[model samples]
Target: MTIADLAGTPAPEAASATARVRTPRLRRYAMTAPTFFAVEYAINPWMDTSTPVDAALAVRQWDALRSTYRTLGHTVEMVEPVAGLPDMVYAANGGLVVDGVAVVARFAYPQRAGEAVAYADWMSSRGFTPHATQYVNEGQGDLLVVGPTILAGYGFRTDLRAHAEIAELTGRRVVSLELVDPRFYHLDTALAVLDDSTVAYYPPAFSDDARAQLRRLFPDAVEVSSADAYVLGLNVVSDGKHVLLPANAVGFAEQIGELGFEPIGIDLSELFKGGGSVKCCTLEVYS
Candidate 1:
């Protein structure tokens, strides 16, 4: 059965629901410009203090991703980037917006803690009632929306306890998954939700139990190779039809193409130094 078929999944926000059909979705997303993007601290495995980050290159790559989204007929909104907050460019970690409810992020590390307050204010400005979580949650980096189901990952950046808080905030069924690999610190690092009905992931990133749950839920799921996962390939943004991904993840591009989705590759190798790509740079604004 599909994730949509799961019991207790939240119903559409509107009382009069339209039929679920395949059409080009005009997606709305929130992004922060990499005006102050940098790698001053190491929170994840991909970050290194000694490595020189080309902020100019990062901005160029980010602008290209934004342009690609607009070209595909998607709305891209900018959140003002704060100086001294280099990681602000990874906007997906700002919050999780579902059915007009914005569950703001509670970052695990002190380095990123200030970002929560910044995103909370931004979310309120965009017409969402911000709901704060007591448990540590890093927004879409760990919490992914699958139709009405929320796939949450923990054992690294996010605390597992936050999954229940997420359910209360969004009124959706939260499927808690464990991230076992240090390299795949966040769920988006190892998994991609292709559409409402399907997902692709790296098996070794998850725990045995989490892997079992995934296998049972998405039998047709694409299993990605280490070659692609290492390059943060699964960190992609999809509007059901087209997927925007890092240009280096050729293997993942081919796999998603087999699933009949157009994979649009954009180079954000500079941003990868900060530990994110297309999906990490974009946060879906559900209404």
Candidate 2:
């Protein structure tokens, strides 16, 4: 289908209405800018930027990472600039579009608090009906939709209250877990749905219960080491059999290649500094 054809479809009906019984699609995904992504400057008190070169390099890295998605056949639409908050420009990060509807997020940071409003406007302008998360939760990075189930991370960026609210909004069973590792504040940092039945994850980031739940849901998950996981770009975006990973991760790219699926890698060093990989920077909505 053409890009115009893809973008021209009307938003799906509200989840509460009977008209909302269509199958959810997962065709395209999006990513945001890496500029102004340094949390140390805006949110992190410990962040000290001793040089301007570091900031310039960070922006360069972010641009390179965003282009990597395009090289993989996935459509990359640049969300316009949001003054002061560069992260806000990547409209995909503000909400999750399941099927054709947009699920708006409740940002945990006060600086990011305005993203939801801007994202809602973006969706509406595109003929999408936006849904909001209950309580406070960062939408793009906190939740992952695998088949019929939504895996949500609770703690740090997303709260339990938001989990319950998401369940109420979509009427889908939200499997919630408390993130044990503070470093990986979001689930994308440690876990990923490779396919409907297969997953790639770092064991140290998941609790016993969460691991059990994962096995029960996806009995075919291929466990990889945290070090390998880092190299694997475990959270890479998937389109049918195609997977996009980080360019620097050679071993992980080779493993994915061995699986009969095409693997494409791009350099994402700048985005990593902001605590996001391929998946975190984008939101995929399919029908």
Candidate 3:
């Protein structure tokens, strides 16, 4: 059943009644400007090099996303975009910082490998102890923090072996899930960690085994629509009480609103050309 069909009161009523139950979390994130964003090569199904991307529009949209985070009282830091890495703007793939320790990203594709080095150095410069990862793990793109667990994704961009590496690096228990859909290649693309104990996901994007795991873990999770999933709706950034997602994901927004979280929609259509949205542009830094 779709989220709307699930037995519940109207979102407006539930939100008004329960919104105060969730505590707002102050977040710190690292973002990269879309200075070098381009669809020059096809890395995922959403990208087609032939479709021209408006460079100016990309910058404007990225600026708006960054501003949105700051406007919500979250700290946003920037890493200087390198000249050759176009996908660098998808900063969540760079590396992940958790509890003051950073695990460097070892990208599965050689096309984006340089991004790992940049993030490792950047985190080290900021006083974080950076740990080099031997296995292929695309940072926060595949590694999501949910309470004490690190929900990792595999079968596409990240290697399953990387899950153990991440667990060893951060001392957080890592649970590996397999992605079956090419369109939803990363965990963040199909699932959003709404809070430490909650999530919203597109079930079809994951393998059956993975879906079972999610159901056992988050029985009350929001199952998003296929329409919203196609628009990269699950690629969201949630700070406990506030969920920020792409403007096109109206249905998913309403679903989260029913959970008493205020959903904030922002436009990142330009970045969508590069197979990313709000969460892709944002990497949480747990300090």
TM-score of each: 0.92, 0.79, 0.94
lDDT of 2 at 211: 80
Give residue 273's lDDT in candidate 2 (0 to 100).
Answer: 52
lDDT of 1 by residue, 68-130 (tens): 788777899989999888999999999899998899999998988889988999988987778
Candidate 3 per-residue lDDT over residues 1-287, each given as its tens digit? 32222211122225656544767889999999989899989989999999999999999988987876787789998898998999999999988899888988888878898998888888988998778777888999999999989999999988998888888878999988999999999999999999999998999999999999999999988999999999999999988987778887888888888778877777888899989999999989976
**Model 1, which residues run further than 4 Å from truth?**
1-22
Q: Roughly what TM-score does model 2 have, to 2 decimal places?
A: 0.79
Residue pairs in candidate 2 whose N, alpha carbon or C atoms collide under 3 angstroms: 25-286, 25-287, 26-286, 30-282, 247-266
What lDDT score is found at residue 186 in candidate 2?
76
Pairs of colliding residues, candidate 3 = none
Q: Where is model 3 more than 4 Å wrong at Cα?
A: 1-20
lDDT of each: 0.86, 0.63, 0.87
Find the 10 residues in a row with the least total lDDT in model 1.
2-11
Query: Which candidate model has the greater lDDT, 1 or 2?
Result: 1
Stretches off by above 4 angstroms in model 2 are 1-26, 35-68, 89-92, 230-232
Provide the clashing-pair count of each candidate structure. 0, 5, 0
